[model samples]
Target: MTLYLCLPLLAVLLQPALCLNCSSQFERTPDNSDLIVDCGTSVITLQINLCTAHWAGFNSSDLALNGNHNNSKCKGSIDTSVDPPVIHYQLPVNDSQDNPCRQSLQIVDEAPDPSGPFSAFSSIQSVIITGYIDTPRSDQGVISYSTDLYYHFSCRYPLEYLINNTEIVASSVSVATSENNGTFIDTLMMRVFNGSDYGYGLSVPPTGLELRTRIYVEVKAVNLTGNFNVLLDHCFGTPSPYNMSQSEQHNFFTGCSTDQRTTVTSNGLSKVARFDFEAFRFVQHRDQAKSSIYLHCILRLCEPTKCQELLSACNSRRKRSLTPFGEESNESATVSVGPLYTAREDTPSAAAYSNNMAPESAEDDVTGLVVGVVFGTAAAVALVLGGWFALKKYYRV
Candidate 1:
């Protein structure tokens, strides 16, 4: 019995020594005074407590087991927790006035961190712009403003006028978006046309007026992971004036004519012209952004006739007339009848002639006396009148 028991113990210790076809090797290590076995392979190494259980057969089925074992294989996998890109934008802090002539305006933007500041989880792929032009009450005529995100990075758009009350001078768009160095820029322009032209037989000059331009900027950030975010900013241009040229001035004034009753004709009427009154410029400082200029335009109207009339009236009052029919007479004279004349008889020189002959002779003497007195008086008055009487007599003759 003693020999058999010793044989079994020896066999137990020698089992690990058997020559297996497997090329892998098993090594033993001591941990806390306990010996552990490490099985090594090309793909993985597994640790086991030699005292717990003996090695079983290396069946292919064991490789399929999902549980932990002394000898296990390792597989590779990919990490998908990558961080996204970032985006940012800068613009003028102040609002801008309206512009009628400019079809486009530039809007500046700044980005310190192309990977963050605005969006940390994505890259900025494009920017969208939208808004309307404000028609200020101070504006002399209607103005039309338009915007295009594709052509202009700034909110600058064209401006125009409306034919009817329902016509819109403002417009919006989502046309195109641009990506530049992880930063986005946009532009817009405005237009203003003449609405009314009054006729005064002279050319009308362009009328200047004040208007407001409003714009909103939105950014789209798309990341490598296909994620995105949108940020918005409200900016404005300064109030600008619509300018007019000499030719435009002519078209404005003579383009329309008024009837005797002061009725105006509309067929030859033309649109109004506008000009920018304020200057617009972008201001940049170290990392911050701000608007340095205001959007605005001056207003003017065609009024050559009015100016000429004013000048003529002023000159007419300055110099006095030298002719006899002077300004005073021309202003005060009236058409009427001339002075009247009456006939008179002298005292009957009666008694001298007694009967018919005496009466007749008396009548003749009386007439002659009256005529002499009248002639004498006339001669005295004529002498006093002098040249004036002579001229009057010549004209009468």
Candidate 2:
């Protein structure tokens, strides 16, 4: 009976350490810990960095007029009825790490094991105040000198699940040569068109087509020190201006190849993965007559551990598997995307053409003389007629 009574007391003590609203792997301190509010002339910058665990997912929608309805995700009110109108705003734990305004938190390592020489886990479970900051006022102050400020404490967990760890880079991209194999050859063939031009005495048929280039996208994945698969969700080469309808921007691709996406698997323990993207067609931009291919790709990084857990949970529910890509597979996906790099061809400058002018031929000289003589005679006649008309008009007047 004494042990049972103590158990209730122990549970009550630990309850305060629990995260607010959302479930997390670590114990969470109150959001008020290490909180500092700096109210500037135009903006309110709230800094909260001292929590053992933190929740950084508060969104802009929570500040709506009726946004705190029922005091669910967030709570607060504005008292316009009072002098200077006290605005009571409470932060909520409704946002996720993938939120655009959310800041990135780095994982901290705990103390080393006393009994063993090795350290603890790769990362520690802690509350980090690395996430979005609420800028209440962008152009003017929301809190007046007499306005009262009453905010609440809010936090949540599973810090590693945030979108802060993924990174993608495009190391190199070039026109795919013949050695890349048959598919490239086929793609090149489709883009090439047979045309005729006789620059000299010789008549030769030339293959004229926009160059079909391939992009190499590298992703700096996280926790993927093991076997995993990388999926290229979408890739499109966008011109600098989206509204550009030039031939190079629009006519390169046979169709929207990005719509038919594919996946690739990295077989061993690798932290860096490479993806070859060839869905986009390359055409010369009008600016310099050099083709600029701005490639953007959305990549999904998947591993086995999280994939299995999500799969099991979805299966137990007897519902259709809600995979990362909404497929039946157990791939916990994190998105990394970018306009990796632009591929452009070299073109000669206008100065080069001007400097390489050819000497004038006798035929050209004769054409120039005839044109000048005709213009000179017409100008002289027009001047004489103008003088006669002026004199006639003056006499009549």
Candidate 3:
């Protein structure tokens, strides 16, 4: 039985023009031939009947795809009891940083046109697997009719479609604004902690603070793919959910921080960025009640090269930047977290309700989100200039 994959994949099966010396006499037996590629979390379970022409009898020793030398590596079993008998090759191929089988990755980036299979995506990532089937020949003639059957196949699994697959998991609260570019989400998780090492997270965020209590904020960008990192372009705090340009606003990055104590301790170093500033309460309006402020940040995704360039250009981040962020490039996405309470109440009444920074409330704005995926890593992310090569699948002739 062929193992079918639950996740949808765009698979391309290609074959050579000649089926070795047997091409003249035999044809592929579709009914008896089975090619199953089971892409598991870590391994790709491949089950393909040995490549042989119709009614051809082949021995295990004569077969060589990955190799016939070691059964522990590339093994096979014969189903001779069946009507015509078939050689089943079941190989567990590993696709990881240590790519032993030499599988490759190719990123296809182009404008969406109304014509082809690629029309749906402006950017797509494809994993390609290639191999050849070898069968020995007897009498070598004048033309040397010896040849092996070569084959190669690829699957298109866009990062967007990666949602249901176990390959990538999102472990944070995220808000995404996109259409056909589903799952190309950008997540920026933030929290206000205390101390120099970003130590001790607040039991309740934006918890009540005294007038001179300097605040420590940490923002992390996660789940980005390819050759890119994230950068904090502009960050500021507003007294209310809305960006009130005039009054109760404090700049953390724009090369301007009212509090000179403010500093971007880390940036472009890793995934997390840290900064601190003396906490201050908004001027209580004559009709106002309690004091609250919100944090807003604009994040940009860039390749390591550009990220380094932007890191130097981000004049205000003297405070902090990626402590980590990546490459191609994309526009920016703005995300925020807060409603931090700065009002000092000895016996605070509303402090208990400040825990709304949960995932459920992450919908309204970036107010409650603490974790999520990174933007620009998906959608028409328009990036990653990998080596372009014309991979030729050849059968030894």
Candidate 4:
């Protein structure tokens, strides 16, 4: 009697389950797989290892195109019975949308396939389907992001690696500015310390310092296609649109070239563009001035052959051994070696030299000249008078 009483209650609960089964539960089999790119057919089909072309969703009765999902329940499933289980689809492929940048495959349930046996499938549609194609790697790939290079410098040698012809490197850099009592002053100080003896193929420890008054420009570039060299073509400054005159372009920021690569040091790395102006030299030309700076660079991916050639050159340079100064042995040679000579002072003793006299006065010089002239004039007068007297006596005789 208890079992019979419970059966009524169980029937009530099971009623909803029966209705769910009776309703067609539409399902697309072999879900979530890559589509084989097909452009020939507009019909939707199914295959073991491909996406379905037509609506494979479930419906109790063949339903017309209506957006209502209450009519049927759709479930997604993956069938793995075949060698490469895939639900194939014959949806028309759009060649225009066949790129990594575009959305090639879109499965929509708003419309039905226009053709064939499952034409009544109003709940599913393949809007766009395209075959898989490998995308080309970006030539100028960004491994790390940084704006610190703008303000602070870092080491450039001992690069981590090269990607797309770009040398993945780090640098130690710094920037500082001081005002000379409201006067504009810019200075760049650079230094470098290498952990290894060989730095860019040099035995001497790498270290440098540079002080410039002009604004420094550091240029950096990467080839996007990996086909050309990265060249710093040009750099210019645009005046702060607001304060054009107050912010005159510094002289140092003139035409910069690709060859003007910066030499790195502790304070900062070499900038691609540097101004010719010094802190002290007075700027005469104020006609051409801009406040903001802009640099244009060109990038070309490097050729594999060129990279190999450069590597070979570097290897050869590193392999060349240092020549030894004439070989020396521990045993002394019979030939006599000259004694080291020390230079002696050749200057005379202070006692032997006369002391320098004070400079004579102009008045004293004038007085001496006057006295000599007066004596000379008086003697001449006396001689003239005596000669005249003798001539007169001789004439009388």
Candidate 5:
């Protein structure tokens, strides 16, 4: 009976041994024993090993039996997995409506490149002029001019308002002409209170004009009261309604040709001289008073040889005198040189040089600032989180 009671006592003591590997007691799994541990919502079964040394006269078999019977119970702890901080890559901010004037009217040959070397000359084949007209029932206006090597000119006419034969000027005239002689010319006139359905008529002399050289012509009509402006641009004939008509054709002025001659009385006898002369001299001279109309046309249609001679003469004159310093200065001087000189500076602005560039768009700058702030904040947060994790690991070690 005593041995039977001892067996029950031993069983009760063995229960504690089994509890040694309990999962709830410790975070790590027991080795070499029938034990189970919990690791963040995961169950880990472990085989725990036990070694015993019996003292003198102690029962080794009993100890072995106790060791074999040891067991454990464990319950896993709940785990909440953290989601990766969503790094919303602030998309590179950009403007939805960037109305950039990609095309520039300034002569590109003179513009400096933002990078290293100067940029190549980009030909401006055409130009589109746009404006808004409010008084005339709100209309958007656009005018385009094709590129012509011979004649290239641009002009603007301001709206003129007249009340009882009085001239009202709202905006000053805006005029730009090329200083490259024989390239462009402009003539301006305004008529007020012309008793007709049309409020005014702006007439330019040599109106139905034709040229023997490459030329560019432009005219502008402005109504001051209405605050509206109209422009007329003509390039000496690549193709158009402004092309040379049969009646418009005139004799090629060979006065400037070295091979041509006219009667000259040298020794009391009429002699034909072969001195070089401009062929279109008569036309140029006759139209001298009307250079605003004829210079471009003459240069555009002038024969190549004639054109070369004119260009050479211009270059020689340009080199000879330093009177014209800049584009506007040269234009003013050329126009003052009578009709022929004025026509040569037709594309005056083409020679303009300025140290200042056009202003930047406000929208682009604001967008860049906004994007910088957003990304900067996100990076700061990420850096703080990383530093915290590193510090925790260091302290634990």
Candidate 6:
């Protein structure tokens, strides 16, 4: 075939590999300007600033949102009035039939564990945006050229809004059970703290908590939308995790605290509802036995617009009801955390206990523990007696 004919065929075969030569990553100028991605309520905006010194021929057509070559929802333009140029893009946040360009949303949640940091967060929702750039097509024979590699970049954002509420709850915790029988809520977590931070004081097994110590707790709404904030309606603590071994103490009733320390950080003003109380042992706790403390909360997500008024009027003598998430029905869900043992007087301090204890040994039975202690004592006594006998025999008086 003629050289001209071959060139045409080669270009057709390499059509899939158009090289946009986009930067390897976000490029920052000496003055500090770089790629900026802004997430908004209904639309997302992205701006890419490139210095003419390094990117002389860069244009707005080199990058595609989600790699959609024919996407109608995304639009872009290039600005060259200044020494460097800026490429701008705007796309809808939501995906629909009219505009097929789609962004992804993800929800992350895990069951709370005994670990200090792990037990505190129950759930989180995040939105992720992605895009890809075109690069040079590979060719050989008579033609030779260098090319940049294709790249896909992503950015993540939490689906939460800015709230102005920052009240600290002052209520203390006591033994209690669930007053409402509603089903359990998903993605809500309960976190415990002994002092300023999450003290390693909460034990596995064979360990115990210091009695009468203050405990701070935070409860967060995970799967709910960003428009709603969690509010504590009622809460109680007990020695048992699920069953009622004894009468429980009341922390909050109808959004009002029974004690000053037993505060609900806000009256449905924030997504994370916080409160605190002191740790105590069961009056009838047995000796040398494994034990735990469980906390139960009856709460719901409420819109900020209606939460303050609804919770404030709780002090009035009129009949009161709560409609969680601005719904007509009185919907609420229960969240609980437990198997938390108070540190025994003989146990290590909270920080050491958290770092040293094995989670598996917590389930060991008391009988097994007692047997091990006895065996160790017997071995020590036998060693002492044997040493005395050997010394007396060696003297041979």
Instruction: Please tell me which predicted candidate would have the highest TM-score against the true structure.
Output: 3
Poorest stretch of ten by lDDT in candidate 3:
160-169
Segments in model 4 whose C-alpha atoms lie over 4 Å from true places: 1-250, 253-369
Encode model 3's per-residue lDDT on 1-397: one tens digit a residue: 2335422221222122122223322344433234545433223444444434333444445554543334334444555454344445533333445443435544443442233222333333322334434454454666653444333334332321101010001122355534322223444466666677666764333335655677777667666434445555556666665332335566666523334657888765666766777766666532344456666554443446655765665465553321001111222223434466665534354554455444455565563232233444542243432212222223322
Compare candidates 2 and 5 on lDDT and give the better one: 2
Candidate 6 — which residues are off by over 4 angstroms?
A: 1-186, 196-206, 222-224, 243-254, 284-291, 315-336, 343-397
lDDT string, candidate 1, 89-123, tens digits: 11221123322111222222322133222222121
lDDT of 5 by residue, 1-397 (tens): 9999999999996663443322332332222222211111011111111111111111112221112212111111111121211101010011113312111122111222222111121211111122110011112346433211110122121111111100111111223343322122232222211112333432222332233332211222222111112211111111111122312322212112212231111110111001111213234335343233222111111223433443465346532111101122221211211122212223235343221222244566778999999999999999999999999999999
Alpha carbon lDDT of each predicted model: 0.24, 0.32, 0.45, 0.26, 0.24, 0.48
Q: Could you tell me every candidate's TM-score relative to the true structure?
A: 0.13, 0.25, 0.41, 0.19, 0.16, 0.37
- The per-candidate count of clashes, in order, stands at 81, 7, 33, 42, 50, 22
Tens-place lDDT digits, model 6, residues 290-358: 345666655544457546755666657443432111111112222333455665444458867766764
Report each candidate's C-alpha RMSD, comma-separated, in the order given. 37.8, 26.2, 32.4, 27.2, 50.1, 23.1
The candidate that achieves the highest lDDT relative to the unseen native structure: 6
| Whole-structure CA lDDT of model 6 | 0.48
Candidate 4 residue-wise lDDT at 326 = 19
Candidate 1 matches the true fold with a TM-score of 0.13
- Lowest lDDT 10-mer window, candidate 5? 84-93
Candidate 2 clashing pairs, residues 3+ apart or interchain: 52-127, 53-127, 54-127, 57-95, 102-132, 103-131, 103-132
Across 249-335, the per-residue lDDT of candidate 4 in tens digits comes to: 322111121123332211111121122211121133233221112121111112334334433644475321211111221110111
